[model samples]
Target chain A: MYLAKIFVTHKKSILDPQGEAIKNALHRLDYEAVENVSQGKYFETTLNCDSEDKAKQITDSICDSLLANPNMETYRFEIEKVGD
Target chain B: MKFAVISFPGSNCDYDMYYAIKDILKEPVEMVSCDTESLDGFDAVLIPGGFSYGDYLRSGAIAKFAKVMPALIKFANLGKPVLGVCNGFQILTEVGLLPGSLQNNRDMQFISEYEPLIVQNNKTIFTNEYEKAESIMIPIAHGEGNYYCNETELESLKQNHQIIFTYENNPNGSVSNIAGITNKNGNVMGMMPHPERAVEKILGSEDGVRLFTSILKSFKGGILVE
Candidate 1:
């Protein structure tokens, strides 16, 4: 078994509306000095596979195909062999 | 034509849609709960606008795993027509049925007003009633309705004419002023406005009546007369 964790985010320079909203909220609450915020989703999943390399391949494909938008967002994946 | 409007627990616009379809358009409609397993009989499935699950854990994140979404996916995959409005639009993007993420409004505040929507693509089942480049007024009420898709996807969408409606004045800061989009097959549509609310003159606008009528016309195997 392997555990894969992924982080999906908008590419740098793309505006993040959620992050901007949070920044606005902070300023409204008087936290005026808070600067530069970005929001992203973190996904962790366990996959049953033969080897670490095979798990990596499957996980990468999922990220590219559906898990994350390769064009607007970039994703990073970490895989580890684990005993269930 | 038979249509079903899926109502989530926190959904507030189910009856609005029901009245829009049944009362205004004089079409037979069903108010279906979000957990319904069978959508095989309906000609169209509508995910009405509302703040589902009280907008928890991101706008449509929690509603994605509802009982009826799997059935909705099946309905969409079979090339049936599906329309998601407002919160329903957010839900579609979250489920990967649509391409972009609907984030907070550009001003970081909830906006509720009548905004002009320019029809960009009239080839889809949803927009067939309108002439290309026509503009109509509809109400948008959302705190998080900004649409974001990468540049590559944006170009492809334009190339394919998948972008159906664009904001007339950049209301929510959506990329390229996009207000709505259709799936690659053009069967599914998701938009960030409440067309149902604008279906009657009593609501201050009747421009939305054409949308429902257009869809019904298509289902009857006829083109929109207007």
Candidate 2:
């Protein structure tokens, strides 16, 4: 088995309104040193693939087709062998 | 002409779209579930607003995977009109039927109110009933209506006259104050405003009636009557 950890976030060119709101709230709490916050999504999935290379390819396709919107967000994933 | 309002799970405005077409526009309309495999026999498709898939991953993110989407894409490719409003608009972008994605409103609030919209390009089938540069009132209710696209796409939209509407006052900080846009072919339109909500004077404004009328006129193969 292989476990894939994925992260999706809005591209830097797009405005992160939710993250901006959270940053403002943090500043109100006197966290002035905090300059920015960008919100994103995280997901973990396990696949019954034979090899790490196959799992990586499947995970990448999933990210491209379903997990991420290429127009507004970017995604990255890491695959690790979990079991024999 | 027949119109089909696609009903995705959690779609709240599908009936409204149906009512606007059947009752107000005096046209035939049907409600189709998102799981249906084919959109055959429909003259046009209307994707209504709502929290499809509970808006789980993102607005219209999961809903784009619906079984009916392939049919919708085929219908669009045939140059049949496809109108997507609010969450429908988001789905169009997610499905690649339309360009650009809707981001959360800059204010981060769920806004529901009447806003003025300028008819940016009245040449398309969806907006042909309205005059160019005409100002009309439409109700906009969404938290993720801020439209975004790359600079090159923005330039092309302008060059192609695909921008159909612009907010009079820029409510959500959308790029270029874009309230609505159409695809390059002009048969597909994705707009954040709810024209279905403003179809009657009793509902507050009749400005939205012209939009639906435009579609009907196109199907009838006639010129604009009013």
RMSD of 2: 1.8
lDDT of 1 by residue, B1-226 (tens): 8889999989998889888989898878999988888887898889988889997756787788789988999999988889999999998988889887887788877999999999998777787789999999999998888898877889988988889999999988899999999888888889999899998788999889888878887878754211
Per-residue error (Å), model 2, residue B109: 0.6
The 0-to-1 C-alpha lDDT of every candidate, in the order given, reads 0.85, 0.93
Give the lDDT of residue B89 in candidate 1. Answer: 95
Worst 10 residues of 2 chain A by lDDT: A75-84
Assess candidate 1 and give its TM-score to the true structure. 0.80
User: Model 2 has how many clashing residue pairs?
Assistant: 0
Winning candidate number (lDDT): 2
lDDT by residue for model 2 (B107-217), tens: 999999999999999888898889999999999999999999999999999999999999999989899999999999889999999999999889999999999989887
